[model samples]
Target chain A: MAEKKVIHFKIKRQNGPTGAPYWEEFKMDYAPNHNVVSALMYLREHPVNVDGKKIEPVVWDSNCMEEVCGACSMIINDVPRQACAALIDDLEQPIVLEPLTKFPLIRDLMVDRQKMFDALLKIKAWVPMDGSWDIHRHAPLIAAGEQSVRYLFSRCMTCGCCMEACPQFHQDSAFIGPAPLGQVKMHNSHPTGKYANEDRLHAIMGDGGLTDCGNAQNCVKVCPKDIPLTDAIAQLGRQTTMQWLRDMFVK
Target chain B: MADAAVDPNALGERYHFLIRRLHSLSGIVPVGVFLCVHMSVNASVLAGPARFQFAVDQIHKLANLGILKPVEVLFIFLPIAFHAYVGAWIWLTGKPEIMRYPHLDNIRYAVQRWTGIIAIVFILAHLWHVHWIIPGGTEFDAHAAAESAVNAMASLWVGPVYALGVLCAVFHFANGIWTFLITWGVTIGPGSQRRSGWVCGIIGVVLALMGLAALAKFKSMDVSALQHPPVTATGKVEPGAQTTGH
Candidate 1:
């Protein structure tokens, strides 16, 4: 018989958020079209180690299985990216999987992305369109030029890749990271969203806000959505400066 | 919604905006502007002892007019203190993962922080060495200036160290001008940022060249010719002021 083609994975396993982490190796029968998530699923069924011994199934998070929902994000071969999009064949042997170091790890490859969501909340990363009923005939028109830029930012999936690569967005740091800043730029461009612009700007102007961005710009490089995060940072920098001036002179 | 996101009147909230903006403002005005001016002032050495001492006399004359003291404190000293204190705090808190992110921008980020550290130390040491450390070796006295300059070249590797420090300081100031513009939102889009990068790059190169040229001028001077003191504004060296250290 021809030698059986195999795929190897070296997953960093943990029992809990505070659990001690250790690497466990497993090999699965090679199959075409297997992504990291599906490979983990195959291993989930087998639960067998490389030593031919029964073990616990590997744990990870996934929703869309496509790249859109970013729950399957993890460190694959030292790069933080979406596991669902990381095709096993394209990756090197014994593909390494670990939780993103910048976040609070849950178990295996899962990490709590609450900090990113909290940042979004802090920045009021929304259009205040849901308040008291004042129904209008038409939605506010946004310029095509502005929409193209806003469209780029609107693709953020709340994945931690940007934060993972950010030098200022670690667990102990107060910097809100770049993801929220992208949302800030996106929402602020909306004709309705601009009403709360100063409020959004005010939220980011504080300690953990926009100024905390170190301009390392790894966030832009690592963003899965290809968001123009640094541009948003620069835009926010400008907005806040204007706000600062306005605060000094007008209000 | 969510109670207006963040509190507007909190201690940190109220001041962080102003403080951060001021931080960038100080970098441009007092800090960046001062670096350029200091380099120009130091470049006077290229004109030889007479012109260099003339420049020194003009600066000291500002003290006689009582303008230099206040200007130094407000523009130079105080801004430096604030910029350094705040800058050090920011630098310390950063989570440096330089090895992973090897992008040019990321490296520039780390370089900026490091150059700030080098610049602060260099400025302090340079100030003390020229202004306060050596007796009668004030930069005003051309002979003492020459003695100290040669001593710096030979003693404990001051010349190379000073040169490195000045280079780092120049890098910090020049690179800082780019960040300053961004932080202030002066460069909004990629086009503007690219243009700003070129502008700041030219500024940095010019500043570094001016500083190095001044150092080169110091190294080129004939040590024996600077043995005698030049006549000053009062036509007298201050009492207890020896012309040379040894």
Candidate 2:
């Protein structure tokens, strides 16, 4: 039988967020369904390049070994995707791997996505559970339609894909980005979450809040969960109008 | 003492001030609100010639009133001009890399700003042709004004330009509405914000299509019987044209 095919990989390596980045190449025996994460594992076992010299084991991050966790996110062939799902056979020769550029580099393919999380906090993207325990005990059940809308919003993994794709989200920006806004909508719809609704609304009302979104719909397009971002925005418009009127009269 | 405190990053503070001011002003009333009104007014075209003409006449009368002109100059023209000016300043000062990449944020911002410029041009030309150029002539007559509007609508140059202007205006307005909601804290959470996004997107497309349809099917008017008789300083028509007046 002829010699089995081999897979070649080129990865951009960074020591830390402020450290210099460099490229490293490796060749491994091809397996029909081998993925980038598996290849990296293989490299960990036998750390050597095509030139036949031993080297340091490659560094990267992974938790779920599945796309759901979003911990394995990296730029493969210049496209941001989870390494666990990127099949080596499907990728072009010399499969390139790099860290997600939208976040601060931790090391190698690892990045700090804390900014996205911080945005979630800034938007107060949570429903208050207070009074809900008593209310739900006596309340009428949710309708199928309401459940479906809630279900759509429940899919957000805080994966930062929407933030990564957003033009308005950047290092310099205080703009909370799209994912957090979706969270705000989800929480506000909750019976308990509605209590803090005014506070949430007030937070986003500032200059760097929702006003920064340019509505290119790029976040929606890139969202893996198919979240209805633009719809939320429109509803928020009417809600804010009502809120504004209510605030004027009440306070 | 609190008010007298100076920020070490004075440049940043200054930049923030300008940005916040522009951002706040841009959100006020929003372009979408104006587009909604414009579309509503234009939809009157479907009510047949007399009603549409009467509506137009009423608008002209209201606009020409001596007291409202300065208010119009201040509120309508000044806000738009200032918005454009500050937008340009922001664009120029922004990182050049942003211009090169044309990311979604940059594209949306650029498109909105450029469309404002386009709208300004369209508004000026529209005002010149319909209000000043057509109405200022000795041949100025209602029939002639109606004919000019129809002619402008039918022209190869004007037809496409108007259609494009309507599209741009609607898109700009809808996008602005979406952004305005965010600015005002309506879509603060991740879930609701995302949901609001879809709503804005759908409305933007729908409103744009509606405006486009109105412009495309606008009915042309007959102007052969147009006659102009002299009027007094108080704008009262002479006896010969008194029957056609008002």
Candidate 3:
């Protein structure tokens, strides 16, 4: 008789936000095409440990089951990435899953990415112009070259992967992190978005603003969408300097 | 829309922008610029004890203008002290993820932080040994400079440690210049940054080489001749007060 093939997972489990975290090992029958989310789903169905004891099903957040949703971002094998995109075959066993340390943990592998969104809100990461407004017809033509950079910045899924990787983005710190900074670059580049550029820049200029970024360059490396975070930061640095000079003269 | 409430303690936002700017400005203007000058002066050891002493005397001569004290205190000491304290706070709060993430930038980031720390320790130790903790109760003046130079080379471990310190400090400054430019908005794109990186790299190598060359020169000096103080204008052996310590 052939022995049963199995996949192993070492998940850092927490009952709630304030609960102490502990690790639990789980075993599942080997199945083809099993990504991390699907493997977790298998664990959800069985709700048993490798020791043959029925246990609570593992908990994680996922919506798209694709990489786009950004809800399944966690530390898979000590690397913060999307669980939906991590295949079991590609990962070395036993796979380790933990929530991002930069954010408030909800439970198990899920974390609250609200701060990331809050940072976006603080930076006002949006074009001020209405979607229904067609002012581009009267304005000078925006070259495809300009749109290309904006397009790259628009791919951010707010996954918190960059935030997790950022050395400056800890829970106790005030750094706005790379995600919001990248959005500032994106929106500020837009034709109409430039109107409120100073406002956005001012928001980032304050407490957790641009100076807080240590230029670790970690944000660019971990970005799944290949956003040019460092470039945005560099550009913002120049804008802020100009703003400072302007302010200095005004004062 | 949620109101953008400004945090009172946010230094960058408030009148503290000057402080924040001073932090970055100090690193380059006084600290970074002074490192280059200090290394070049130290490199005079390549021409032997006489030339090295001469180089030291030249800097001391700045006192003739009655501005050297103020200049050193303001440009050299105060700026460095400010840069170090502010930097220590940032480094303490940072979370290095190179071990787990293993990305190139993350590795660089981690290295930068670690190097900054190492450089700070080395600088303090170097200052203490050279400036404050003079053996034999000798004031570290120009006459003692060459002997102290030889003293630092007397131990086998001292040379390598000195080299490592120079390497770390030079790297921190060089890599810092690159970051400083980006942070200040001078380098806006990949091309500019890449060019600036190459420039900083070249500067680092040159500075490191100059530092190591000085140490190597010190190692090769004739200790017998180094022990004797140089003659003054009156042809008498000048008493202690010449050499700058580690």
Candidate 4:
């Protein structure tokens, strides 16, 4: 008879927002084709520790159990990504999971990712439109290259991987992180969004805006979506320069 | 939103747009440009003291050797003061998490800030010894400068200090340039950045080598006949070679 293979799991757990964090380990009979999401589900059902003590079920956030929803993001083996994508077979032994350190902790592996969303507000990541619209003959002609670029930026799910990996971004730091910067480029290049171009540029021109980026280039590397965040930063850098010129001459 | 953007009484936020850009611009124009020229001029030491002193005299005649000169005051001193001020604020606040990320650029992110700190210290010390902490005349002759520079480099620690200082300054300038492009939006994409990276790398290596060579030659020179200079607004251009390198 073959020995029963067991999967070892070490998880960082917190009870509530004000709960003290502590470590809990669990062992499960080896299950084939289990990603982190499924494995976590199994653990939550069992809720038993390695020491044979009954414990509270491990809690996390997830939606669209594929990688698209950007939820189920946690530090697995020190890398932040969607838990649904972290396959058990590929991950190293004793898979460790922790909450992202860059945001406010809500539970064991969930966080208040509201900061990233708030950053979206800062960049005004939407096109302006009035209710009373006159009919136009055609839609705006976007170049194929520009469409491809915008598609890449549009795929950003606000996963907080970029934030988790960014040195300049954390709970306290004012750097608006790379996700919003990419959105700014996307929206600013947008024909309809171009009306708010100067407004968007002015928003980021302040203290915690573009200049705060230390240019670690880590945000691009750690982005699971592979968005060109640094490009956005550089583009905004140029846009703001133009804005400065306009402020000097036109304004 | 437009009305809310610019507040007259908002502390610090009001000029952040101009101040931040100025910080990036200041690092490049006068300060980064000066490091390049200074390194090359100092490297003339390899051609022997006569050539080295002539390079020094050319600069002294034009820019002068004084704690307070118009060209030096406006261009060199003011820019450096502002850069250091803003740079210090940036360095103190920005924390580097290289352990978690550990990417090459992440490591460089830390190195850039560090070299800034080192370069500033080195600049002040170097200026104190040779360039401008004390009052000196505009017409500091070739022999006098060669003598002063030789004796300055005569110390046991000066060579190593200069070697470290030169490398740090060059790295700071080159890296500053890379970020400056991104900061000012010159190289927007990764392909553009990679190409600029190659150019900046070459500039850094060449500048660093020039600075190191200058240090090596200056340290190996004969400083036995270090003499006081003759004070005059109209000093002789040539007064025989005062020193030679090993």
Candidate 5:
């Protein structure tokens, strides 16, 4: 008879935003091709600790089982990444899961990434063009190379991985983090969006804006979409300088 | 939405924005540029004390620059005072995770902040010894100035202190150049940053070497003659034994 193999998990569980955090260890029957999300789902069904006590099922947030949605972001094995993409087979035994530290924790492994969204609003991370009426264009001539670069910036899923790793993104500080800054680069690059470039630049020129970034460059390394965050920041830095000079001259 | 978008007052005063920009600009143009010239000029000591004194005299005797006092005050001292003030605020507030993060850029950021602090202390001490406490006062001749610098570096502790100061200042300036580019949007992408990294690294190494060489030159010279007649500005000749020999 073959021996039963089991997966071990050490999850940090919290009841609510202000709840005290505690750890619970679980052992589950080893399943083939199980990722963190699947393993978590199995734990939800079992809800038994390593001591064999039935407990409340662990809760987390996820929309897509794939890595695209960016909703299942958590600290797995001390790295901030999407739980959907973390393979149980690849991770070390006694795998650890924690909520993203930069955001407010909802429960167990779920975090509220509202700060990142709010920053997007602050930076106006969208093109000004509204679909009030359909306008025809002869050709929206964009070079392939330019499209490729734009595509890179557009892939940002607001995962908050960059924010989680950033040193400047703290509770007491007003830094808008790297995600929205990249969004600035994304929209600012668009042919139509360039019309609102001044507004975007001004948005980041104030408190907790571009100047707050300490140039740690941690955002680029942790980004799942491989967004060029540092590049965006540098570009924004230049844009803000130009904006400041222009403001001095004009206003 | 129009009010929210258009109202610049939502952020802070326009002066805060301008001051922040000035802080970055001040570091690069007047302060950084002046440090480069100052270090290169100090490197003249490698040719011998005569050459060093000659170089110092040329700077001291600039004709068009109203007086050395005004030029030093406006260009060098004022910028440094402002940079130090703003830099101190930044250094205090910055929370570094180099130990936990340990990423390459994280380490660089930590070191840059730390070096900025050390460089501030170094600059203060250098000014006190070189500019403030001259034996014949601030208007001392180039020879007297060179003699005082040599006398100061003659000590074991002071030599290493000046060396460390120079190294820290050079590192700060070099690393600062890289950040300045990124902050100012001059190096907008990773490729450009990588290239600029190489250039900044070379500049740092060269400047550090020049500074160290200047110190070594001071260390090697026999200034027993200058030490004997080391007269204070108040016409008091200091004890000869301290400066006479190594």
Candidate 6:
């Protein structure tokens, strides 16, 4: 009888945010269409390390178990990505996993992504509902070009990969970073949000605001959602200038 | 003192969260947008002092109007406050050990943040020296006023400050411009982003030099006329003729 094939894995482990980080190896029985997350689940059922010793169940955060949620994001072979989408067959042997670096570590694979979310709030990354709360209200018509731009921005899943890959984003930064700038582009594109456009412009106009970004472009490359962060920043640049001029003259 | 009353942890929790949000969004305006305008304005100096001064006067006039002044104040104050507040907050909360290294990416990021600190100091000093101190109504005569302006520029202390300010401004602007392009999605591909960075660096240096030259010219002018008063009934107004020894 032929032996069943198996997949090997090496994951960086940490007990908590402040706990010491270490490595553990595991081997999962090969199955068709298996992904990193699935293998992780298998290990959860049988929490044993390669050293032939029983260990605590590996800890990680995942919601959708699919690529859409972005909850299963981690570093695979030093590249930030969604674990759910990483196929075992596609990765090199001894698949490695680590938490995204740019965010605060929560545990083994979960990192605090509140910074990215907070940035969204700071930028007012929303269209003011105004009188449109009623479902019966007429929806605003969006031009095709505008729609395309908004669509590009809508892809952000609040995943921290962009932040993780960004060199400028760190524990010591007040840099609002690139992800939120993309959100600025998203919200500003909406007809309703355009009403408070000047406010949004004014918000990012300060010290640690847009000016803080060093334009490394690493954020866009690592964004799982493929949002056009760089483009949003440029548009905001032009928009803010107009706003600055308006603020100078009108009020 | 008032902040001391609040639970340090809770205060951190509430404000830290909001500040992170504000910091992230703040990039769209002052730093990102302002850099573009600043660079373009500095470029005008290449056209000569008249054009540069004209632009400055126009900006001042527009910015000084009643309603506009408040808004302008907000524009300047909010971003600086938010950026500084958030930056300090992050520094306080963040683990600095991991960031102490000198990777290329890390070095650039650190430099950018440090420049923010430098720019903030320079800006405050600039406001004090130029807007408030020198032009705030010390000199009664035009010549004296001009002399004061020139003297301010020529002073050993002030010269380095101006030079540093220009350098910091250009570095900040160039770095922000490079990031602005990426955040906006203008330079997506690796090749494009790298090329854009190079272009930004070159342009930033040129703008910095132009701004420095403009500032340096202010110091090079002859301030002798300023030191001397208008010829009076006497062959020349004694050094102490106009009492108060201005």
Q: List ranges where model 2 is wrong by over 4 Å.
A: A1-4, A20-23, A49-55, A89-94, A126-141, B1-65, B85-110, B117-246
The top-ranked prediction according to lDDT is 4
Which ten-residue region of model 5 chain B has the weakest summed lDDT?
A: B132-141
Fnat for model 2 comes to: 0.09
Docking class of 2: incorrect
On residues B1-246, what C-alpha lDDT tens digit does candidate 4 reach at each position? 553534535756678778888999999999889888888888876766656666766676664445337877788889999999999988876778888888989999999989999988988777765664443412233456666676677778788888888899999999889889989999999999989988999999999999888887767767765443332334332454233426
Ranking of all predicted structures according to DockQ, beginning with the best and ending with the worst: 4, 1, 3, 5, 2, 6
- Model 4 ranges off by over 4 Å: A132-136, B1-9, B62-68, B131-143, B225-245
Per-residue lDDT of model 3, residues B1-246, tens digit only: 214477545555675556666788888998999999999988977755655776777787787888877887888878888998888877876878667777665677677888888888887777666664324332456555677668656777768788999998998898888888888999988799889999999999999999999988777766765544464654333556333222
Worst 10 residues of 6 chain A by lDDT: A207-216
Q: What value does the lDDT take at residue A208 in candidate 1?
A: 79
In model 3, the Cα lDDT at residue B103 comes to 69
Docking class of 1: medium
lDDT of 4 by residue, A1-251 (tens): 98889888999999999999999999999989999999989988998999999998999999888899898899999888889999999999899999998899999999999999988887789998845777664667899999999999999999999988888887677788889989999999988889999888878887778888989998899788899999999999999999989989997
**lDDT (Cα, tens digit) per residue for candidate 3, span A65-146:** 8788889999988788999999999999999999888999888988899998988888778877566857556754568998
Which lDDT value does model 6 have at A5?
80
DockQ, candidate 6, vs. native dimer: 0.07
- Alpha-carbon deviation at A159 in model 2, angstroms: 1.7
Q: Give model 3's DockQ, 2 decimals.
A: 0.51
For each candidate, what is the lDDT?
Answer: 0.81, 0.65, 0.82, 0.84, 0.82, 0.67
For candidate 1, lDDT tens digit of each residue in B71-115?
778888899999999999889879777887888888999999999
DockQ of each: 0.57, 0.11, 0.51, 0.61, 0.48, 0.07
Q: TM-score winner among the candidates?
A: 4
Candidate 1 or 3, higher DockQ?
A: 1
What lDDT does model 1 reach? 0.81
Q: DockQ winner between 2 and 4, please give it.
A: 4
Residues A209-239 of candidate 5: C-alpha lDDT, one tens digit per residue: 8888889998898898899899889988888
Model 1 residue A179 lDDT? 89
